[model samples]
Target: MAAPLTLLLIVAVTIRAALYRSSLVDIISERVEVVSPLTAWKRVVEGLALLDLGVSPYAGDVFHETPLIIYLFHFVIDYAEITFMLADVITAVALYMSAQEYNKQVFRKQRFALEADRYPMDCIELIRSPKEMYYIPLKVAMFYLLNPFTILSCVAKATCGLNNAVISLFILATIKGNVLLSAIFLSLATYQSIYPLTLCASALLYLMQRQYIPVNPRRASFWWFVAQYAFMYLGSLFVIVGLSFFLLGSWDFLPSVYGFMEHPVFLIFMQLAVISIFKSYPTVGDIALYMAFLPLWNHLHRFLRNIFLVSCVLLSCSALFPVLWHLWIYAGSANSNFYYAITLLFNVAQILLVSDYFYAFLRREHHLTYGLYLKRKDGSEATLVLK
Candidate 1:
């Protein structure tokens, strides 16, 4: 199993790496054309740097939207169009399998080895007891490794779910009760986009689990989380101040980078997401579906967290885009940022459906693993695993 898995992983990664490298050529050149119906998708993403330059001497220069890691800015940020092409493409693929493998490895190595028994008796409780003889798919997501959704999402990178892979690691860590990891990832996700908060439902899990056993509320692990977010947003606040002074005139009408919270359209969608999360609790997969679509809430700067949240609400209100486009065409309301906002919305929706599919398949694999477990057990207390 190890050798074959290793070989397959190698082959899969190689193929993906080659494709991403090729995509880089087009992305860097802006040769990656914005297809229509999805035209708003293209422009909105492209608008950020453009708006940043509106009042500056660089306004005449074309702005680029290739995403680059914050630390890579020394060489990349000034180039605009030549932004993080290679990174985004590679990160996209890495997000798919790397995330799957990372999560599964965490489970197999840290989870089952310790709490060997009481697995199917209660999947959640499996974390506490040290015994054997049951199987649980939630302990290891089956479809994540085998499923082609990651490939599909990669082939279709324009969407939010695909773009969100790296960041989703953070969201998932939060779900699994890794605080420092979650906060760190959340900070990264918050900077990447404001969309991750929709997955905030995972926070409920964290709060509950923290109190479940020996976790120390007073430990630095607990307070480390507070400081991490404090710094992330505090840094964002500083950026907002600088941006405020930078875009003094456009502050009122222009869409904010932190618009995930306050944009009219974004607000509505976020509310719907929250409601859906709570309402769908009865169905295991429904909450998963709701989460898969929640986009990242990043700070390009210039607004409050609340404001950014609202913008997400508006952009994701896909129902209003026709009117928005009409307004743009009529020179009424559309700005370059409008396109950016809407594309983020489209991406979120794409991720939701696809993620649910992956999660569902994981559930199916759980059923199969359990069937095997029932047959293999000697009815003795000892657990029999594939290994």
Candidate 2:
């Protein structure tokens, strides 16, 4: 594990170091498709400057990052590049360790279930063998370290890498059954970005599963467990938010950071619907989706088909983005509509990629439980219909 991880680190560092030395770093950092309002390194620097001058970093709307992040860079501004690189490395290592631990737990549960005859005889084939799970951690680490998005983010010095690292650490702590560490890391992630609050659902589910607690809402034990985790998550979030308030002496961040929560649940849903319906910048959505959870879907790739087509579509989209942007922004030969058309195509390709894998995963699960081939009542072959 150390040798392979060291090799991966060497490769990743070489790529980043070369990019840093090249003239492309500046160009990549300014691209809208690569940097956003929240994760842009430029804004972080701006905030740090204001902090150094004893001014509130949030005085201007230019800095949208959380207070914690600004303070983090205040002391380490000179080592920004190294900080971003270390964040990426930390994220990869945490994810690798978490994956290794998770596989062991899953295999142990499977063995116990088999000995207890908990699974149907026909479901035996669905059971994963130790050999297949052996290198999953290494593969996960490699996928994350070598992923193009991660590389681009690192080279550009986008602060998204830090957010990802925090979330990855949260996952690692959670999988290791350290409730306090998990809650703290999770709160740190939520402080950086509100999107990670959704991860609470998965954390709760994993904890419950680890305890062998059935998810029955009517049970007191189930409710007690939910309350316990919820309290820890919310308590930590509250403390962090209060600290931010004390640091800034202003509540301006409340609206910008968590305004989505001001409304009732139905209103929140409506707000999201409105944003989706009226959004003019699909690139933001595309990048957010791709960067966040794409690696987690690696296991579904083997079950999917049309890999060649999906690969081509994705690669073509990646290449075309800059070209289309150039034509629209500088060339002015192409209009917004032209750029948008490619954006739409890119998003559609992403949808197809995810949907195909989803379909394949469901189909594979069905085949594993029931026989791989199905027959109709009249002895004719049957086909599976998603509808």
Predictions in order: lDDT: 0.36, 0.63
Cα lDDT of model 2 by residue, 243-304, tens digit: 43342232223223433222122122222222222222212322432333334445456677
- Highest TM-score scorer: 2
Model 1 spans with C-alpha error above 4 angstroms: 1-5, 20-163, 210-387
Q: Worst ten-residue run, lDDT, model 2? A: 210-219
lDDT of 1: 0.36
Give the per-residue Cα lDDT of candidate 1 at 44: 32
How many angstroms is residue 252 displaced in model 1 relative to the true structure, after the best TM-score fit? 31
Task: Estimate the TM-score of every prediction.
Answer: 0.34, 0.73
Candidate 1 C-alpha lDDT tens digits along 51-131: 454543123332222243312443444542222233333333333333344335444654654466523542343232222
